[model samples]
Target chain A: MPVVELEGVTKAYDGGVVGLQRASVSIGRGEFVFLVGPTGCGKSTCIRLLLKELEPSEGEVRIAGKPLSKIPRKRVPMLRRNVGTVFQDYKLLPNRTVYDNVAYSLEVIGEGRDQIRRKVPDILRLVGLSTKLHAYPDQLSGGEQQRVSIARAFVNHPPLLLADEPTGNLDPETSIGIMQLIYRINRTGTTVVVATHDKEMVDKMRRRVVELREGRIVRDQESGLYRPDESTTEFAIRLRGELGIGAEGHPN
Target chain B: MFFFKEALRGLRRSTAPALAAMLTVLITALVLGVFIPIVQATMGAASDVRDRVVVDIYVAEGASPAERESAQRAIERTANVRSVEFISKDEALARAREKNPRAFREGSELLGSNPLPASFRIVPDDPTKVGQVVDRLAPKGPEGAREPQLTAIDEVRYREEDTQQILSVTGLVTVVTGGLALLLVVASVALIANTIRLSIFARRREVEVMRLVGATNWFIRWPFMIEGVIVGFTGVALAVVLLTAAKESVLEPLSDRWAFLAAPDTIAYPLLVGLLVLAGVAVSAAGSGLTLRRFLKV
Candidate 1:
């Protein structure tokens, strides 16, 4: 079964604004997928829907083969426990140390002290931050902070990992390190979905890419580059426009 | 254990607002402590004065024995009349001389007579109903019947103004203290709520992070609630200490100086302490809980 599936999902905000209209996608287990789109193109909306943060206006969202609409409000946390999430800004608790930051996820779910002690250090070592366990977020570099966030997300070994521009704020070199860490995490049989506008990284990775334009999927292909194919379709024209190429599908 | 630690940490981080909340609770509790006893004491003094109020019926000096007997019988038959004691002319003279010997001597020498009328002191069953008993015994008639007749009674006298003053003072004391207590309570709650709101606002980002990390609403709320309870208990403890000190150093000395104005002893010290602590906890906990509802929408 697909680990993540959105069948005809639609999201409309107030005042008749379309966030995502009839958007659909699916991801098999252990697959690495990149969700590339411009701002307001429903990338964050899609991630939010998967996390059950926002309800889809008109469709089914099934994570791990269980429909989200069927999950009670009290069970959202349970769903979240099984899904790891990372953000570009590194949403680490400023008051906590790196070790505590990773351990917090387990503590919230009432994991035993022995399990937390075993897992937090192991995950931190995986993210290459085992030596910086006592450092606070403010004490770390941007790359180090993002690593803490990654460690926190992956501490539980969730089946699905979602990273929303995990390296958006980093330098190119640091971004590469962060991407490598995520790639390694995805290799451990965990389905990874990254939503980003990182063109260089998308072109370099050549993984499965799902492109969105104005709340609709414009392209879905394995080994896709950052830019669209050499076609004159309407979606290709809009994609070219978004990529800042000329109207005739050629670089300026 | 985690909640407790988090709550203590929260309290430590927001020391300024927590201290302000504690002070508000202290001031509120102090006002209640002082006024509650004062109001009780005032009422007690008023009732004491009321119990001592009696009506005095002065008879003419030349009244016969039969007339005195009739007057006594009339007083006994009056509703709410508890008891009646008759003082003869000689007994009245002797009592007057004992009370003010100089005035008695001067008056007897100047007038060459006892110059005192026999009287009956009538006590009522209920001190509050002295007016009714007095009215029953001394009935008013039309103006045509106002002439001085050959009746045994010369005049009727009681402390009308004193009783009225006590009643009015106690009534005013009750109303003013009750209002002030209510106002203080409301002010305390508002102050506490505002303080909690500021603290929560400062940590709104932290709350968002917790929500994103799948922390339940109760998990996010327990820390604030515990912080509020801590603030409340601390405030009550401080207020109780101040009240105890004030009672020992100020109230005891004042009560000693003014022997007639009794101190409040109806409520025991332990019970008062327990009540103050309970009120402090309740107000602070309720204030935090109520204010937190707005921020827990996540």
Candidate 2:
């Protein structure tokens, strides 16, 4: 069974901005799914929906076969316990050491110290950040910080992992390294969904790619590259001609 | 134990704000500690004064010796009267000399001519009874006795000004101390709420991450709420220490030197300590709960 299911999900922000438009997608356990889209095409929103960060206005989102809405408020933490989240910004608490950052997810779920003690070191080593355990977030490089963020996300060994532009701030080499790390985590039966726009990296990987255009899914294919059907000049022509009557700098 | 260690790290991370909050609470508690015991002692001493004041009534001229005895018996029987003593003219002079040796010289021009009155000194076990005794014992004389007095008593003497002044001062101390304590309590609540609010703000991103992971509302809120309580507890402990030191080193010494005000250490110390600690825990818990409610929704 799929670990996450989204059916015709739509999200509209206040003041009439649409974040997602009737989007539907499914991701199975151990599957590595890449979301590729232009800026503001709901790629991040899609990941957020799967993570239950935002509720869809028009459709249902289900995690592990249970409707997100049907999950009781008190059980939200339990639901999170089985899922791991990473962000491009590397949201490690500044005051905490790298070890504490990875251990925090366990602490937040009230996992006993013994479990945290046994699990955190191993997870840090898996992320290749064990040597930096005592280092604070500010002391680490951008790559190291992102690694810490990844380690924190994977520390609890959640069955599902959502990374929102996890490599957005890293160099291309570092980006590939992080993607490889994501692939390793996926091999462990954790479904991985990454939202990014790195064309070269996405093309070389040749994984399942779901591309978004203007808040809608334009293409979804297995072992796909980044926007294989849409040419850049065609988009430029559309930007200048078919969408010419709209405001300048607006893309369709 | 681990949370405590974490809390210590958190405090070290944000030392400036934590120290400021701690000092604010400490000063508030110190003022409370100093005033609470002093107020108690003042109140106690006032009541003691009310009970101990004695009223003396002098006998009329030429009242036979038997009438003096009757006056003494009458005063002793009065409501709230603890005891009554008769003082002869010679004894009155003797008491006067004892009170002030200079007033009664060794060799006066006339030695036996100290024409002081024979007075009945009356003391009531309860201060409230002084007025009652005065009221019940009126003039018991012939038909033509003077309007205000005097077959049995010629004059009455009581330290009305001194008693009134002491009670007024004690009442004022109680009102000021109580009012200030109430003010500090309100301020402590405000400060604690503000501290928790800032602490919540710092952890806002962590809360967002937890929500993303599908953490239950309780799971996300428990740690921050606990942090608020910890801040409150630490602030109170600091304040208590400051208070104890101030009372021992300053307020106690001042009270001891001032005869009118009993020393606070012996009298008000326990009550002060109890009130400060209680205020600390109550304000901290309430403040934490109130502030954390806003963040729990995330």
- Report lDDT (CA) for all predictions: 0.82, 0.73
Q: Which 10 consecutive residues of model 1 chain A have the lowest summed lDDT? A: A243-252
Across A20-63, the per-residue lDDT of candidate 1 in tens digits comes to: 98988999999999999898898998998999989999999999
Least accurate stretch of 10 residues (summed lDDT) in model 2 chain B? B139-148
Best by TM-score: 1
Q: Give me the runs in candidate 2 sitting further than 4 Å from their true place.
A: A107-118, A230-252, B38-180, B210-238, B256-260, B263-267
- Candidate 1 residues B1-298, lDDT tens each? 9889988878876688888888888887888777666666665665566567788888877788998888789888888988898988889989999999999889988999777888999888886788787766665557523222338888777888987776677667667766776786677667766766776677777777776777787887888888989998999899999999988887777876886435554466778889889988887887777776766563
Deviation of model 2 at B21, angstroms:
1.9
Per-residue error for A36 in candidate 2, Å, reads 2.8
Looking at model 1, the pairs that clash are none
Against the true structure, candidate 2 reaches a TM-score of 0.70
Q: After superposition, how far is residue B215 of candidate 1 from its true place, in Å?
A: 1.9
The alpha-carbon RMSD values of the candidates against the true structure, listed in the order shown, are: 7.3, 8.2
Displacement of residue B285 (Cα, Å) in model 2 is 4.4
DockQ of 1: 0.41
